[model samples]
Target: MIKHIVMWKLLDAAQAPRFKAELDSCKGLVPGMREFEVGIRTEGMEANHDVVLNSTFDDAAALEAYVVHPHHKKVSAYLGTLRESRAVLDYST
Candidate 1:
């Protein structure tokens, strides 16, 4: 399985619900994506991102395909604007 993780620094809670809906929408996009999880930090953690995603795919190719998938790209593009900072890690097991 391929593990893809991403963390994001959000602007505020006001905008989170909208994107949270969209983030949930992501799960239905790529069938190759075996698992999808989105989280919003609740403890006001300063050194961490507000939003995070952890997903698994069948393999690296499936992960790459997800990266290039049109819907995924659209989500990524939207994320690029709202997030102050972002981090990602992709690995396989």
Candidate 2:
């Protein structure tokens, strides 16, 4: 399986929820998507990022399809406007 994890630091902290919602909207967008989860930072957490996504795919191809999906692209583009930084990790487990 392929695990794709991402974290984002938003330019506007208030937009964290909106960003998470946008990420959640991409769930189930393609086949072989095993799991998808989006989380927002807590009120008092010592965190650098505002949002995090933990997703699993059956393989690299499935992960690629999810990445290139139209809805994913739209959300990603919108997120680009809101995020100050992004970190991603893709690995097999």
Candidate 3:
């Protein structure tokens, strides 16, 4: 399986909830998705990013399919407008 993680710094901190909701909408978008979770920064932490996503896919191809799905593309494009920075990590487990 492949574990895919992403962190995002939003242009507006107040929009974190919206971003998390959008990320949640991506759950089950592809066949091999095993897990999907989104997290928002909590108070009292020195947070560099506003949102985080931790997900697992059966393989690299499944991850690719999720990336190219129309629903994902739409959310990604919208997020591009709302984010200041983004980071991603993927590894096989």
Candidate 4:
């Protein structure tokens, strides 16, 4: 399996809910998507990013397909406007 984790620092932290919603829209968007979870930083938590996307795909090919999927691209484009910085980690498990 491939784990794809992404954390984003938003330009405005208040937009975390919106960010999470946008990411949630991509759940089950492609074949082989095993799990998709979107999370907003908890209040008063020790964290650097405003939102996170923790997902798993059946394999590297599924991960690749998700990356290029049009819906994912659109969501990414919208999120780009709201993000200050992004951190990503992808690994096979």
- Full-model lDDT for every candidate: 0.79, 0.94, 0.96, 0.95
Sorted on lDDT, highest at the top, how do the candidates line up?
A: 3, 4, 2, 1
Error of 1 at 24 (Å): 1.7
Candidate 4, residue 32: the lDDT equals 99
C-alpha RMSD of each candidate structure in angstroms: 1.9, 0.7, 0.7, 0.5
Error of 1 at 83 (Å): 0.6
Q: Of 3 and 4, which scores higher on TM-score?
A: 4
lDDT (Cα, tens digit) per residue for candidate 3, span 1-93: 999999999999999999999889999999999999999999899888899999999999999999999999999999999999999999999
Question: Model 1, range 18-90, lDDT digits (tens) per residue?
Answer: 6666777778566678999998777656646778888999888888887888887898888677777878998
**Which of the numbered candidates is closest to the native, going by highest lDDT?**
3
User: Lowest summed-lDDT stretch of 10 residues in model 1?
Assistant: 41-50
Over 4 Å off, model 4 = none
Give per-residue lDDT, candidate 3, residue 48. 85
What TM-scores do the predictions have?
A: 0.85, 0.97, 0.97, 0.98
What lDDT, from 0 to 1, does candidate 3 have? 0.96
Off by over 4 Å in 1: 44-47
The residue ranges of model 2 lying beyond 4 angstroms of the native Cα positions read none
